[model samples]
Target: MSKALDANNRRWSTLVWGSIPVVLLAGALTVDHIPGTDVRLTVPYAAEGPGPTFDTLGEVDGEPVVDIQGADTEDTGGHLNMTTVSVRTNMTLGQALGRWIATDDTIVPVEQILPPDLGEDEVREFNQQAFVASEASATVAAMHYLDRPTTVVVHDVVEGAASAGILHPADRITAIAGKEVSTPSEVQDAVRAKTPGESIEITVERDNEPHHETVELGENPHEAGQAMLGILMTSEPAGGVTVNYNLNDIGGPSAGMMFSLAVIDKLTPGALTGGTFVAGTGTIDDDGEVGPIGGITHKIRGAEEAGAELFLAPAGNCDAVKRVHTDHMTVAKVDNLPEAVAAMEDFAAGRDVPTC
Candidate 1:
């Protein structure tokens, strides 16, 4: 009886030990954070002729237009490049572990990347709205640099927001409370001055005709005692100059600064890039303010791989910039559009520039 019991015990121990390896293997393959990688930035000027992506300024109504140069210059070696990150979603446990071991990529919880309640369609819609906002910001920046009048227009209305049914996409908000506004902050201030649930008069220009609508203000979800209209706004050229951005599939406002720079480069004479490959990522506003963006480390890697010698990083993102491998590229910290342009000019002139 004692011998038989010992044999049964040995078999049980062996089985338990064998199962440990399988469990560990399964855990290793489990999902973790999304992986981010570099995507090449394309300049729209490289496109054939003027269309949805490229814009060429010409005489409008017999008025002389800006003499834009560098469309045909072959030796113009510089590029106003934008940066993007490749996200790896629903990764297995083993794959996540591999990414962690590689150290070249980052791991983030799924919830951190996206809200748990958001569906795929909602996410896509959000991305599309972001793209529109970026285009508007870029257009405004360029128009501002050109000293042209611009207007802040509604790009997309957040679903379930106060303005969802009251406002539509592409509707240009001309004024709030009978006072004309041009920038987003002005509109916000106009709304914030009012109490939540108060009705405010909003004038929007659609199809070249003005229409007035009464919108009830809603409480700002982020701030207490603040009123919000629940719409995404963008800048549009009030003048005859038109800027059309044609990059498809790519979303987010991170490319705003780069797009603005690209437009400025095309509108002005000579190469703003200083004849060297330059890449950057930042959210630009109509007021020329630069805002921080995510996936900057991945963008840095992308710029480095694309043969970019200079990188323009938003000042707010210095911490992430410090943690990334910049390799041989010079990373310059910029707070606004003017500073960015100056840094690029300084680099092209072989002068020392600011670095983060």
Candidate 2:
């Protein structure tokens, strides 16, 4: 009996020892944190090319007051490329570990990429809205450069909002309550004057024709006693040159600067890119002011990979730009559209240009 009991005890000890390796291996491989690196995962780059990208503006009503030298030029010059980043979600333990160890990829915290209380759908919708706003801003910047008349229009309708079903995206909000509203604030104020659940007549220009929409005001979720229209808008020329963006599935405002450059290139004579590969990312406004965007380092990688010799970065992003190591790519810090254009010109002319 003593021998049998001793043998059982030895077997128990052996089983406990054998399980240790499996437990350690499991712990090593377990995904304790969401894994994704900012480094290895490069955001896709799109240029003004054959597919969905910047294209030449079609015929408009009035003749050009200012003569555009290369207004009719075809795809002779190289394209101004825009950079984008892919948002990763639900990464596995192994994938996260791989990214963490990878040299090229930088680990991005889960919170930064995915904010709390926000779902993937919400993020996508926000991106889509941003994309629309970028298009409007690009159009405005292009028209502003060309010295043309423009108007502000509704670019998107927020989901689950008052105007979601009533007002469509890209519907030009011409007037509110019989008053001409040119800016987004004006539209907001017009809506604010009315009570929630009240119906107001809004005039919009769709497809170059006047179409009126009667939209009911929704209560502002954040503010009490405030009316909401649940739409996103940007300033656009009332009768300006039409610039069409063919980017499909790619969302976000980071492409605004590139889009504006593409428009300028198509409208003016000579290559805006200076016959060289140019890549950039920034948010462009109607005033031609370039705004900072996220993921500058990743974008630099993308630009470098695309064989871009020159990179146009927003002035606000210079601090971040300084930290990123982009080999053989000269990064120029630009504050506005004019500066970007000048940088390209200087590059083409072989003159000393500003660097970040």
Best by lDDT: 1
Worst 10 residues of 1 by lDDT: 44-53
lDDT of 1 by residue, 1-356 (tens): 69889999988999999899998766445523223534322111111110111111223235322232323212233566677777665555556556667647767766555567896568778888887777777778777876867787787899899998889998988899989988778898999999899999999988889999999999998898898999987777775456666566677788888878777776667778878878888999877889998888878887787777898999999998898776689999999889999999999999998988
* lDDT (C-alpha, whole model) for all candidates: 0.75, 0.74
TM-score of 2: 0.66
Decoy 1 TM-score against native? 0.67
Query: TM-score per candidate, in order?
Result: 0.67, 0.66
Off by over 4 Å in 2: 1-76, 154-233
lDDT of 2 by residue, 240-302 (tens): 545556665778888888877777776667788778888888998877899999888878887
